[model samples]
Target: YLYNGAAYLESTFAAFKQRLVPVNVNYRYTDAELVYLLDNSDAEVLVVDTAFVANVARILAELPNVKLIIEVDELGEGPNPAGATIAGLVHYGAAIAAAAPAPHIERSLEDLWFLYTGGTTGMPKGVMWPHRSLIGSGGPTFKPFGFAVPQSIDEFAALALTVHDGAHDPIRLLPAAPLMHGTSAIASWGVLNSAGSVVLLTSRSFDAAELLSTVQRRAVTNLTIVGDAFAKPMIAELEAAEERGEPYDLSSLRLVVSSGVMWSQQTKEALLARADVACADLLGSSEGVGFANSVAKRNRLAPTARFRLGPDAQVFNDAGERVVPGSGERGVLAVGGPIPIGYYKDSAKSAETFRTFEGRVWSVPGDFATVEADGTITLLGRGSVCINTAGEKVFAEEVEETLKRHPDVHDANVVGVPDEKWGNAVVAVIGLEPGVGATEGTEAELRTHCRATLAGYKIPKRIIFVDSVLRGPNGKADYRWAAAVASDDR
Candidate 1:
């Protein structure tokens, strides 16, 4: 697992980062830390993931001067949040290696390829990727001269549906989230594919104030956030200040995207409210399939649709049947056209996630989703988080949603706790709305609400109210963290 994120650092400091980074290197951080890293690098070009806009856009008020703000479109073609730009954007491949004048310029699959993984679950690592590995539907769009991508919604959205015609600008990026994860790195790769610039956020501080100041001073056009982790906090900061009548400017920004995790309906709307520009939410995985949504479009699919990943993907079941999606039946998600080369040094884990099916090989990222007849995929969350209580099986998210609507409840985590009566009983750890106090008896009130709202099995048998729930930098409710906290609380 050789790491090749050298281009991310400045030429003077590049040597320093390379020395410390060995075969397998991970770079994990929050938007706050990412902002500091980018500023310290003093990069002129910023290659941003569309997911971290909420975190970095306002901080643009801090950066004094910066030239380009490139946003990577991993799928290459899709409707973007920004009102279409005239002709400057490109995917990483084309933008970086185009040598119309510099005939001496050259690029190859041997060039550094960067990798990102989910870091909040563990330490962030950066895997060195070679260009040859970046190809097809699973890989970055490639070309003989260099990698290319679609330029506008017409080009990208069309190209994603059809075969690309080698016409995308390397969308450079300033990933507002930690650059150690696949979602952020792949977004950056989209820019690198075109040899476009990737602005690094190297500082240890990714302060929202710093980012807002950077955008305003730098005139940054693109910013992305990773799900609600980065998004909700940022908007909350702004909203909190706004409630106090403090004004902040977020006008220069053009595009903001949220991905890696699904943004709650409320957070998504809050972010869209801040934007005079476009906002998008994407869903995909490092080892599986990828799709994006917008505030207006709200990415969704009917249960009966069948999607063709072109020649790049296919469907199958546990028995290896081509698990065609219909009647609400879901199957393991797989990728073929451009599957990853398995995990680094862990072939067994790789084989588990990456598989061989049909005549072609496939990689199942362990997500259970149904593809509708219209081609849209309906994600049903992680299979590991599936809840089985009593004789019925329920997804934890379904129950969590019910708890969240309690009006007094701000958030909730539903996990199966041991029970002699019903086997694994449902236990919910809930965070209440701000200013509301939780008494020892608060659980009873919340339970009464659930009884009125949810099915009997779906209702939690135990409710533990906490002042606040702990989350990773990404804002995702760490079930493991919650599990330990709940056990300790009990």
Candidate 2:
């Protein structure tokens, strides 16, 4: 589904009921990228917004498997892009109103769920998950107040009806993150399954004011974001509103959840100071959910990068032995329970990532971390994007986070480029804050700032400033773009 948040829910639910796997296409993808994803997924039906009709038209002939195109007339005028005419074209609203309701099919726990990775490291790959496993991965955490899991669909329906009865109220959720991202879609589905309502922002882009205003107007109870990319801007908007004596009524908001990126403690603390809402930073990926989770509340914020280990989550060293906490060994984080089967159509990659060790299978998606003395995990970022310099490993996210902590740095992406001296030199591609230009000594200043907390080798060997750092709609770092910039600089 190519539509925005909540806009595609009807079609998504329909596809799920009919056992048709919904393949997510990042709206920011180019025509070629879109075609590759659609063709690779073997998609038979595509439901897209009118705005994307032109892009789809360019690749329609290449995607023979896509037999039908359902266009959502979001603008009400029913815009049909030139050359987009197809034999099986249908408008979303009209088709829904005219077609008879589909009979309910028996859904098994083994039903398939596909979520394509953002492809920060390489080409996007779909992660294959079973419905039962996916539910087990995220369901327990999203359980409705005072309710337990239902044994059957009938029981679930009955429970859903009564979930909002008595003293409990239905959850009103707003997913500020794009629905194309699993983080937002899964959370939205959990809310809907609990007989709750989902509020969506109409703006095509991430407008902090629009999101905050929607939350206030809808009285949304839960808000989900994709870490600092969303939180930092939203917090700035809130602060600006307060300064102007027009603070939003955020009292109805109870929970703010973030996943898929590094959420800083500073941003969380700033948010908590403005409201009493609880902030949950979930450490997860397309492969699985619940590697770890950290919750922050007023006066109870956890340190940045520190997360309470999740159920069945452990750190494994190179030899596949579980890393002992407080042993000071850096290892890859793995989750054993309720993980994806493997990456679709990539057996070698799948075998390497999902493996059996000590009689248990685990999904290790290359997230480097360390176990503290108290058993909490400190995330070091994805090993797939780790930089190797002078035989020492420097996680890109660690450096990127440090760079972002700078007062003048708006955003940053760290990458490793070939270097004669260091083998792989750490390079920082930064986006400075508006009105904060890089002076002659700015790079030196950034390096000095990093030296305070990071080892000398971990600091960037070169700093490249840009107008903006390339990121996906879900706010994930675009390492490929950063690497290209770093290569050009080299």
Candidate 3:
């Protein structure tokens, strides 16, 4: 499905009901990228908004596997791309009305679920998830402390329907991230699996005010967002509202959750100050879940990138040995337990990611981290984007976070570009606060500020200020773009 959260939920659920696998398409993908993903996934039916029709039409000839097209009346302007002359073109509403009720199909634990990765390092690949593994280990199953998961589907359904007397009301959740992203999709599933209502933001773009308004209108109990990219703007909007003497009514919100990107400690504290809600930062990826998580509440805020490691998670060195806490050794984070089978149609990549460590299978998604003396895991960003400068490994995220800590910096993306002297030079591409100019003095000030918190080697070799740093719809940094910009400057 190629749309926002609202349509994504409806279409994904419908496909799930029929035991059919649904592939996620990043709506922001260009025609060629979309064609590559669609063809690679072997998609047979496409459900899309009218706005994307032209892009789809351009690639229609190449997508012979796509047998049917369902056009939703989202914009409600143009004629159906699949008109009478077009074979297998059907309106979404008409198709639903005309089709008979689907017969019950027994669902199996082996049923497939595909979530394509964001392709920051390479082309996006589908991660194959089994229904059973996804529910039990993909961070969705509502297993209370000391409670075992139900054995059967019927038991699980019964558990989902259970409502205790005087218990908190059914969770009304608002996922602010794009639904196409696994973080939002899995979160929405968790809500629906628990019989809760998911209130989706219908705006084409992220608007903090609109999201806050929806929360107020819907009496939403929970809100999900993608790290600093979403939280920073929302907090800014809240501060703006406060200045106007019209603060949003966030009393109904019980929790605010963030995943998929880095959520800074300052942002978390800012949010807690404005609303009396618990904030959770999840550290995981499409291939694994619950590697580590940090929770922030009023008067008790977790530091940025610091998380209490999950039960099934462990940090391992290059030799596959588990890294000991306080050793100060960097390693990859791996999770044991129910995890995805592999990347769909990519056995080589799958084998490299999913490996048997000490006789136990684990999913290591290439996130670099270190275990502190207290056993806390401090994330150092993904290894794929890690910069190698003079043989010293520098995590881009750590530097980016430092850059963002500056008062004038709005956002930052760091990348490693090829350098004759350093092998790969650490380059920082930053977006400053509104009305802030990209002056040499500002760059010098940022470098000096970074030096106070970061090691000399970890500091960016070159800082390029831009109006905006490239990011995906789900708030993930576009490292490719950053690298290109750095290369061009070099």
Ranked candidates (TM-score, high to low): 2, 3, 1
lDDT of each: 0.54, 0.84, 0.83
Per residue, candidate 1 scores C-alpha lDDT tens digits across 332-451 of 766665445665545666667767787666767665666667655555556667767887766676577567756687777887776788778788888887789888778887878878
Cα lDDT, model 2, residue 360: 87
Candidate 3 lDDT, tens digit per residue, 189-235? 87676657899877788999999999999999889899989998998
- Candidate 3: the clashing residue pairs are none
lDDT of 3 at 422: 91
**What's the TM-score of every candidate structure?**
0.63, 0.95, 0.95
Off by over 4 Å in 1: 1-130, 133-172, 195-206, 240-246, 288-315, 321-326, 372-375, 401-408, 439-455
Residue 437 in candidate 1 has what lDDT? 85
lDDT of model 1, residue 408: 80
lDDT of 2: 0.84
For candidate 1, what is the lDDT?
0.54
Local lDDT at 150 for model 3: 54
Which scores greater on TM-score, model 2 or model 3?
A: 2
